[model samples]
Target: MMRFIKPFIMPAVALAAWGTALPASAQDKGPIRIGVPTAIQLQIGRDTQTGVRMAIDEINAKGGVLGRKLEMVVADETENPEQGIAAIKKLTADEKVDVMIGGYTSGVTLAQLPHIARSKTIYMEVGAASPAITQRVKSDYDNYKYIFRSFPINAAHQARGLVDFISGMLKDEMKIQNIAIVGENAKWVQDLVPILKKGATEAGANVKLSEFFDTSTSDFSPLLAKVKDSGAQYLIVILSHASSDIFVKQWYDARFPIPIGGIDVKGQDQDFFSRVGGKAISETVGNFAVRAPLTAKTLPFWDAFVKAAGTAPVYTGVGGYDAVHIYAEAVERAKSLEPDAVIKELEKTDYTGVAGKMVFDETHDVKAGPGFVNLLFAQWQADGKREVVWPKQIATGKMIPPPWMQVQ
Candidate 1:
């Protein structure tokens, strides 16, 4: 039988064993706890953990935050909302973490918000891109003031970026006409694909196919064939929880002629090329982790992360890294670890992070545009290196046609 679970129910056993928060002065004594709730098995989650640790390592080496060493604790949320709630409860109620840093799937983040509000522990969201997550802050600031996203802008802004990419890069520069939109059926993508379709049509292109696939979708052959039969000259695939690597491999194996781009979370991994056995040759993803030195800290962090994590970091990894530093800065400036004080300081954030300058808007989401947190498209070039190809200013290389298309 199908069962319906309560919106924010705590597991009875865990609730019974929850730990008490440390009193005022005692809270500042030991290490400042930073808890991470993520799908630990995924690349985004793995990088989130690494990014948080990188910041803690840097701060500790520099004599620590408020003279107290920083520490990270992890609980796997596994892309499940129930698991997400459990993870947040464990972090705020059991671990009593001073700050929480990590998120990937949007549904999971939405599910975890209420628990965060109740605990009043500051959460620096590193991954999820739903605009609704920040909407709560604008709608109910008193309760959701503890929430803030430090990376990758939001889905609405991201859709606008996609429109810009399709308009400038695909349409004007490449003379592309027909385009198709493929995205996961998740809340975030479902909300974004409409705006993208409208904007793409208004920007001048025949909207060939707009399809949403299930997250559990493994066989993409029929979908790819349909997209091909539709005569789409360019394809934009948006994926978060779905397995992007599999789709990329299938597309390559079929020698798909369409030039593909847009957000692919797994495709942002530094090792994705080899992970897909070089099947990601022409795959382009909306990425911020490209090594173009968007800021002075960008290149150094990239090199450091490579050495530390034994691979290149993804956009979410950079998000986590930025969140920790932003939180630490707020703590130092406010001269206290209290949630309210830190939140006020966070609202005034203007840190030039690995991607771009980080600042919260009226909704507490990062501001997006040129000179701020702009989205850049990065493609796997023929030489097996990823390079930015859009918006002109920071592009390392131009977007090239796929081998199959070039042959034609």
Candidate 2:
């Protein structure tokens, strides 16, 4: 028999509260506090907050984990790196949270890494794609083992799928070959570009020009002109924080003839096409979910999120949902609140979340590829509809070039 899930209401006094904590029994009477530090102003934060709260509400409704109710305390880690570090401190030190979930923007996430290690709080990083985050764990496990990136597989890992998709799909369909890789000057993109270059070159694709730009560079006209002049058949972008709306609109309006593809983080939002006034047509971007039933839990989570948030969740929103459940399962397996015990259980997790089987490798980063998590490239079709167009088996539609470069 299935249990009916209820929609969660935001608590009135969440930040000002503390769970009861005293000398407790084998099963602590106090609630397990889950601290969330993310950029509340951005879609990533708002949706992630909803996902975490939804998971917590579900567990509590089912009598909670190990007889201890779960609660949440949130600290807004605005886009600023300083604010992000302070939010980490607040959650770890002042709030005394049992486990931490949430992070966005690589720079801010990188700044909070040391603070998280110092606090020794098991942080399930639901966002942030910098490979450096988990490389620290591989480089020095004793201090960094407390950290784990639960979602959005690292940038270096993402490159493999993107390269294959760009070189294989476009070439096979439209006979397009040359690629000009442009990325936002951010840590995760920096990590991704090199891997992308290597993979594309090995796939017999030409790299016409590879350049990066600052996140604040609003005018993409000059760069668009450069890509146009470079004679590249396709434009592979690695933008996360840069003005993608402006860049994409410019790309579409300019009719550069080069189809855009790669990891445009902003384009992953469910309402991106509508939000951008439908300029993202024919733009294929890397994604985590497409409201498809990848697993049994996938559609339930998606429907619940829509019912609660009044909109479809962005990528990190799903990450936040998976992180909470993963945390609770780890704690239950260990039967203890201690970080070390839970860490052991988390390492052995084979849980099938919305995306796929989330199994962590030795580096504590989620595994990517066959039978694990595969990077899905989704295209924004006509009228704001998105269709997964890669990995053929699960692809909803085939990749289409912009009207300027129509396939024969």
Candidate 3:
């Protein structure tokens, strides 16, 4: 009695399907082909893929979803949007993947959305943070039924959490009247500034300079000099894994001394810290999704992930892992892999995941609450531990602002 919504051919489907024939056995076989774009090149992507692999292994080890073995066809998007769309087309058209997962960059994810909807296959967004994904879904409900996201929207919630942490740490602790916001000039970050600004103002922090740079920019001296002269007590740094490492190192070399904190710090995975060296990460504060004191629900996932990845799990891994489980649970709930049914089941999901609880809102976005607000501010201590310093309830340690942040 299972039913499926037929695929709607969008303009790109024809463009993508040229010279390619659809798989014949795709309708009869139960093998779920999952298309994953290349995110493994970066720390976040690597961690995400590791988590996904672990989840798939676990699922397969146990009895696979919908009585079908899960197979993932990973394509290297190489951080290109067009390439990502091509990958989706190949997976959906030639490979006939039932679902698609993996898109680290918002741009890549945005570009692939049209193709995903057209194919009528489920697309579980694991790592992209652009709010537009879910917002568009809400706005265009009928057109975007097959899309679902599993990551935090933008830096808004985390940014607000960072501001609250800074305010508490300052406590008249310092005359931190001015602040600077620096992020990669991407759609996600561009959309996040206003949210960050509102949160900073609520915390009594002034936005002195808001700047954006290309993700490929290696040198940050010019930006650092501007920040140092801005009279800002704190700097909010938001960039991807590679650019963030470069900025942190350049900022340290410049000896600007202002306490810098923001997204892309802990979110990039521990490899980022290791790449920058422990000394560089010390005394820094930023928002992170998964931190220590793993809850009962997340501990098993952590253990499995570490064992599979051969390293500690990062925040991005948690999202990727949870996305798989959430998708599987939805598949089971619907007892079918039909896109619409799976989406309906996804909306009803209330499972407790590593990130906390997973439940999709009307826009197929995870509802905001403990799971959504898991964003915590932490400082890297001397003992090589990044201790939580904000939201008193879960904080494991105190906030230690650097000397530059202290008012002379």
Candidate 4:
């Protein structure tokens, strides 16, 4: 079911029939092609691909959806918005994929939206946290109804979760008063920092130092020194794959007394400890898009994923796996591969996969509030292990602060 192909392998010919749904009679003829146009050059991309494959294999093993094999056609977008647009175009117009799943960066996802709308490809965005993707669906449901987001909470909602945890739990328990914010100067984090700062301020913490560095940055001494000098007790780092190892290593090397936290995507990797010594990332708190052991289905999936991929799945990988199943369930419910029929069935989704209960709201995004798919928080302990530590209902353990960050 998971078939890998080269980019642009599918030729584009028909134009006017792009947006129209496939005829019902023609739907049961062949495999269900699910195109994945993503930054396949990166680790995150590979992780996502692994998850997608795992899901596809499992589904196909179970006789697949609508009694047809689910095939995955992956394209390397090279982390470029223009490349993403081109890749999606090839996927929809050429490969004629029944649906599309993938997007690690927000900017690239936003760039591909117009093409997705034009082609009427059912796009389940597994990554990319920018709220605009779903907001656009809300604004023009008739046009953007084909779009859906399975992972990556919106910026504002992510901010609220970080604020609530820090203010309601960390601040009181650790006696935290001042904090600093540090992130890469990407569009997603650029949009997220202000929201984080405002939330931190509202939660009774003074923003000591707020800074953004280029993704290419390797030295974090300047930023770490500023945080130490500013008397900040916590450093909220907003970063992804780029510069995460450098930032963590430099932070540990500098012996900066402040505890690190925030949207640490890289820290979610199973190789984090090996990349930057176990002691280095210990006690570092951050949020992940999805963490295993959250529900009854998560652990089994994670174990199988690790056995197949030779590594534990990351947040993006979890998202990719879930997205495939989500699409399969929709197709099963619709009883047709027609784009319109599947889209309608998708709108009525109340399914739960490895990620969480995925029920699309009016905006075609996963609902995230009380009694919904809550964001996951975790902390790396000194034992070189990580565990879920928030949303009391699903927490695997209580958040523990490093001795340095604890009240004296």
Candidate 5:
């Protein structure tokens, strides 16, 4: 009787101590924590967080993944790289999150990668399009096993599409000869220049001038003067949300008559266009993820997002929404909380998400399908509505340049 009682009593005591040490872990067996590092102050950041929240709510409402309720731990990165890294560290180490989703800027995303790898936690990049994220995967595949990006690679698909569309429109429609590539000197656009140049040459368009301005450049008069003197018929402007608005306004103020067009134009939110005003923004053509008309393929996502968020949908919002759903799908496929299993599931996915048919290539980069679904050209009309002008299949209206930009 004493021998039997001793063995049973010792095992019971050890179980009681373990349970007391981790009480919460014992009680709630079905709550997976997801860490979100948001740039709450930024427009795109706000929209992205909103989208992610909407997805989480919907998923929870419909019986969450792996029979567990989903929970989010949100931290503000403040649109700074250092802050982003700190936020990620806090989330991964302190909170012990199963996964992470958020990143508006390329620099922030790049800075957070090492920390994510070290922790061996899954990070789904929602909006950062820097090619380095995916391109590096091919060279250092092991380091990127935990990182997956939902947005199209920066300037690869879109830049190629823009060059082809612009050149065809110039030769067959606008009949222009020379073009200029202008962008802010940031990693986002610098990596794009070479790709744009290659595509432009293939399209038989002469790139007469390729200029890069500092992100801090407030005065564009000097740059506009150089562009005007270069005799370039088309201006391809590529800059981030804030700087793009500044450049457009300054280009108008300087009375630079070149027909401006580029990748950074249409993907931004309505606030960006409003900041420059309808009149000032009118007839400014640029390429974006989806055409301005919002086709059958895109309208459902736009509608669902607007309904969920109670606001107009933007590109970043779309990206965030897709990121959440994509991550959930990967988790379900992996059927485990481990990052390595989820990475393999993500690599094998061919999901048709809000951004279009998303298939993760060998390098962990999603291949956004062909044509306008992946990118589209749009022009800001006088009616405060941006119209799709290129990729005739989805064009809501024809290409119409501004009064100041009509062919000479």
Candidate 6:
């Protein structure tokens, strides 16, 4: 009963050339353009692009929106704010895409918002995690209602789950109290650290050291040395792909003997163990969106992705797949491509995507709870396996320290 469209990717250069071919009015016809950030420099960009393409394929096979095929125009954001703004401008002003989705970095997504608001094109966030995205809309709904996030929980909302998991699972269950908080020095992590600190304190956990480093920082020896000296039971991290593997490798090579956990995006990817290699991130735990076999939608799509890409869907992939379907459903419900009409339909969405029930709040951010798209905490086993370990209802296993930690 499912129909899928053939997948295609239009490079930025070709997209620019195509956009320039249109006259000033740029009459809307042909394919429905969906702009995406392919940021080949970042794996998450490529991961998300796969999901967008998959969703578009399914929609086009279903006859697409208003009889027009869904197509993707990609530009590289490279996890940079300036590049993100430039790519968005090209997609909106040049390519004239009807919808835009899949921004991985919080800073990059925020940088593109002002232009998106002015352009009035519907934008669905796939990976940006800043709480401010929807908050900006709340503060100025008249100008920013055009923006919506399908993936990536607002950092503020996720903090509660992260904290509670740490308190209940790590602290109480595992008897971990002294914790060192380390995160990337970015807007999203900065906003979360304070909340994490407060929650940890409230739960009777001691914060040994709270530190942040630039995303580009590769040498974590100094940071590990600090954690080692502090004698913390756990090192809570907030990081992405750029430095996640590097940190893990460094930690393992150094044999710091402390358990690592929290929000490590790259750590949750199916390829993480192979990519990082040889139990480097063993016993490492983090929260992620959708892991296969969690919900009905998860396994089907997960199998498809692994079949096509030789790997399972990452969080961004989950987000992109959901965003495309959400957009398609909106267009169908409104029966029009008019931005306002589509926005109205999007605002009323209650669809259950690959992750979970996606119902938007006043600010257009996914509501966080057990019944909704709740965060799943997972731990990497010693044999390079990952298992969900928290939120008992969906958990696949319990948290266990690596052999190295057990001896300590």
Model 4 spans with C-alpha error above 4 angstroms = 1-28, 283-285, 289-292, 397-408
Model 3 residue 306 CA deviation in Å:
1.7
Rank the models by TM-score, top first. Answer: 2, 1, 6, 4, 5, 3
Write the residue-wise lDDT of candidate 4 on 1-408 in tens digits.
232422221011111112234456554688889888777776678888887887777766555666577788988777788888888989999999989998888888898898999998899987788888889998998889999998766776777777877786567666787888888888778778888888889889888999988888877787788888998877888887466778877777766677787787777778777778765454455554444555566777777666667778777787888888778877877777788999898889876666567788889888777655666677787656776776566677766655445444
Model 5 residue 243 lDDT? 65
lDDT per residue for candidate 6 within 221-272, as digits (tens), equals 9989998899798888888745677888888777778888888877776777
Tens-place lDDT digits, model 1, residues 1-408: 111111221121011111233355654598989998888888788888888777777766565667677888898888899999999999998999999999888999999999999999998888898889989999999999999988878888889999999999888988888999999999889779888999999999889999999999999999999999999998899997788888998899888878788999888887788888888887888986678778877878787777677788887789998888888888888777889889899999988888888889988899988789877898897757987888777788878777777722
Ordering by lDDT: 2, 1, 6, 4, 5, 3
Clashes of 5: 0
Local distance difference test, each candidate: 0.83, 0.84, 0.68, 0.75, 0.69, 0.78
Error of 2 at 85 (Å): 1.1
Score candidate 4 by lDDT: 0.75
Tell me the spans in candidate 2 whose CA falls farther than 4 Å from its real position: 1-28
Off by over 4 Å in 3: 1-28, 170-175, 265-267, 283-288, 370-373, 403-408
Return the clash pairs for model 5, or none. Answer: none
Estimate the TM-score of every prediction: 0.91, 0.92, 0.85, 0.88, 0.87, 0.90
Clashes per candidate (backbone, < 3 Å): 0, 0, 1, 0, 0, 1
Model 6 TM-score, 2 decimals: 0.90
Cα RMSD to the true fold for all candidates: 8.5, 5.5, 9.1, 6.6, 11.1, 6.6
RMSD of 1: 8.5
Q: Per-residue lDDT of 1-408 in model 2, one digit per residue for the tens?
A: 112235564332112112332234734468899998988877888888888888888777666777778888889888899999999899988999999999998889888889999999999988899988888899989999998999988887899988778666867656778889999998888889999999988887889999999899988989888988999988888887888899888888888788888889888887789888888999998888767868777777788788888888888888998888888888877878889999999999887887888999998999888877778888999898888888677889877778776674
